[model samples]
Target chain A: MELNKEEKAMASGELGEAVKWAINHQIKVGNFFDAKNFVSVSNVHMMIDPESVGIDGVLFLENLVGMGAKVKIPMITDPRGVDLNYYTPLGQTEEMANIERRTIKACTSMGILMTNTCVNYQTIMAPIFGEHVAYGDTGVVIYSNSVCGARSNYEGGPSALAAGLTGRTPRYGLHLEEKRIPTKKFLVKFKPEELTDWGLLGALIGKISGSYWEVPIIEGINHNPKSDELKHFGASMASYGSIPLFHMIGTTPEAKNYSSKFLNRLDDHIITLDDIISLKSQFGKKGDKIDVVVFAAPQLSIFEMQKVAELCIDKSFKVPVIICTSPQVYSDASRMKLIDQIEKTGAKVLEGTCFYNQYAREIGLANGWKRLMSNSAKIVNILGGYGYEPSLSSMENCIASAVAGEIV
Target chain B: MKTLLKCHIGIGKKVQGEVLSANDNFSARYDLDRLKGIFSRPQHKLVGKSYVDKILVLNESKGGVASAWMLYEMCARKMAPKAILFNKANTILAQGASLANLTICDRFIDGDITSLLSSGQRVTVDPMNGLVSIL
Candidate 1:
């Protein structure tokens, strides 16, 4: 990979050991992908939850801080693993919380913001068309690339940190124009009516597309989806298939520029309502006993909080119900009394932490929560691997089932 | 007899280990029980199988970015696969391997790495040279 003068300087340790390490790491990744050069990225978002980072990753961050590492551009974080204010009651150990504290301290020492959100595209700043960013979290990358017309690949925590240190990423994958074109085409026969429907549709498409390299161009949706709907769609798709970018005809920004010829003779798969139903049907049966109900994955936006609050009014949950939202939305929700309304019915609204990445197996064991139900398809898909018999439903139904302590 | 398979040059050190091959896709956050060092996702082909110390051979990577960091965390606890071999790896797996310094190679010139390798087979992986030898 060709390095500019500044990049060469960083690689040569003229900038510092921290930056030299960052540049060398980027070079290894760039060479692996055959990147020609580096592209300046506007921002960086990192996913470094304590459960993922562990003690080793935290010590690594501290070492970088000791080396005087500071971010070159605006950098933010994904959801934290522990909601420090509310971890104990949710079964998180002190060791876990201590790890979280150390990680946050190390990050802050390096000038990184504790945005603590996977929904940064919704809650923080949405990247504009043709903008380049190095963002962690598969959901964030897919949303920025597909919905906002930004360019990014699935930058994991380490790469995002490297990008933050250098303010640039390798010029490969989604950064190049030719790679963004449709590799597969899908014609929708059924329209998604609700958030879960959209999520199911995205999950089905993602499962079919199956690889990061396959970009699916979707057609036949007559109306544009709202931001919250697209959040569930993109999040679920990324969770299911590891797909980073997608295009929806007449919906997404880049999709408007392409014609059907962009399909490049790939056969169009017709997506039907049965397909979505089949995917959802694999989870759980109606009236099954529920141990916990959750609303998170890509953390909820303020609008979603309002909707959840509306459903929670006057309803008391027999099973524990947890709602995870970004701190940005949490403050606004508190001001609007949305938090109170939702929590009035025995649901705990956790700020700045998603359910899955928060040491899910330990929490499940602590709470004895085997049969978990959630509205988010992404959460349902993830919890299954963590020893939970996850069931999927709509927000309204999830609330009602939580009240009844069964899948209604 | 030794069979040599070539692949695109990949990340990490050269090493030899037993192979744990499966045609299913992988994600450390989604399909693994990191604490147990086993494939925990019920739908996965390797469900309930231990991955520690073996070279994991899978079709492709799926799901979230947490795996990049999770790999390092797993390695820190001394409970991680010896290496990973994929037919095609997404950016996250490659980036994770880079951070964890775990051996990972993909884009095999030989068709379907899962078919080329099998469970319990001893093999040597040279990531820098993109060679895998069945021993």
Candidate 2:
């Protein structure tokens, strides 16, 4: 990897130990991917969730903070593992909360903003067209890359933290221009009427695309998808495929730029209603009692909060209903009494945390929540491995199921 | 008998360990029971098996970015695979391997690493040389 004079200085430990470590780390990853040079990123987002971070990652961050490491550019975080205020009831141990606190303190010392969101594209400043960023969270990367036309690989916590420190990442993967071209083409023949439908479609595309290297170009979607709908779609796609970027021929920016060449062949995979239904059928059936109803994967946007709240109005839940949202949207929803309305129906709204990252396995065992039902296709796919019998459905159906205590 | 499988040069120091090959995709956040150092995901082929110190040969890395940090945490606890060889690895796994300083090689010229090595095979993974020798 080619480095400028300043990067050389950082590499030589003249800049600082943290910067040196950061640059060296980038060099190794850059070289592995055969990156030509480092690209300066506009911002960075990291996921330092406690369950993932544990003791070592916390200590690692603290070591950097002790060495006086500070982010060169704006840096935010993805959803944390433990929502400190509401952990105990949710089965998160004090050990987990302490790790979260230490991690937050270390990150704060290094000038990272604890945005605690997976929906940062919706809540925080959405990255602009062609803006390179080092973002953690698969959902964030896929959304920013596909919807917002930003360029980012799916940086894990350590890599994004390194980018935060150096203000640059090894220019490889999605940062490279030629790699963004459509690898597989999909023609969407079925209508994605609900958010879950969008999620299911995205998941099917991702599964078929398979490897992280294959970027699927999608077509034949007649409707303009809302932000939350695309959120589920992109999140579920990334969740299923480990894919970083995708192109929706008409909707996304880069897809539009390369629309002529990209859409020439759209017969790689033809998606139909039967294909999506086949995938959905594997989840669960109606009348299967659910342990809980959740409205998150990519945390809810403010608009989604309103929709959830409206559904919760003058209603009651027979089973637990958990909704996760970003702090920004949570505050706004709180001010609008959307939180109150949702909570009135015995639903719990956790701010600054997504359900999957929140010690999900432990919480499930503690609450005996084996039959998990969620509107997000991403969550259902994830919880299956975490010892939960996850079922998928639409948001309206999820709410209905919570009221009836079954998959309605 | 020893046979060498050439792969793309990958991250971390060379390591030698018993092989645990599975055709399934991997995600520490998804398939692992870290506390017990076992594959806990029911759908995974290696479910119920301990992965600690073994060379985990999988089809590819899939799902979630948390594996990046979890790799380091698991290594810190000595509960991680000694190395991971995928037919194709994702950006997250590479980044995680760098942080954990764990050996991970992918894109074998020999093709289909899972078929090349089975569970309980002893192998030496030389990531810098992009070669894995089945011993």
lDDT of 1 by residue, B90-120 (tens): 9999998888899999999979999999999
TM-score of the A chain in candidate 2: the value is 0.98
Candidate 2 docks at the CAPRI level of: high
DockQ of each: 0.91, 0.88
**TM-score of only chain B in every candidate structure:** 0.98, 0.97
Candidate 1 stretches with Cα past 4 Å from truth are none
* A84-104: candidate 2 lDDT, tens digit per residue: 889898988889899999999
Q: Give one digit per residue, the lDDT tens place, for model 2 in B1-135.
A: 339999999999989989998889999998999999999989899999999999999998999899999999999999999999999999999999999999999999887889999999999999999999988
Compared with the true structure, what per-residue lDDT tens digits does model 1 show for residues A77-158? 9999999999999899999999999999999999999999999988889999999999998889999999999999999999
**What DockQ score does model 2 reach against the true complex?**
0.88
Model 2 reproduces a share of the real contacts of: 0.88
Residue A340 in candidate 1 has what lDDT? 93
Worst 10 residues of 2 chain A by lDDT: A258-267
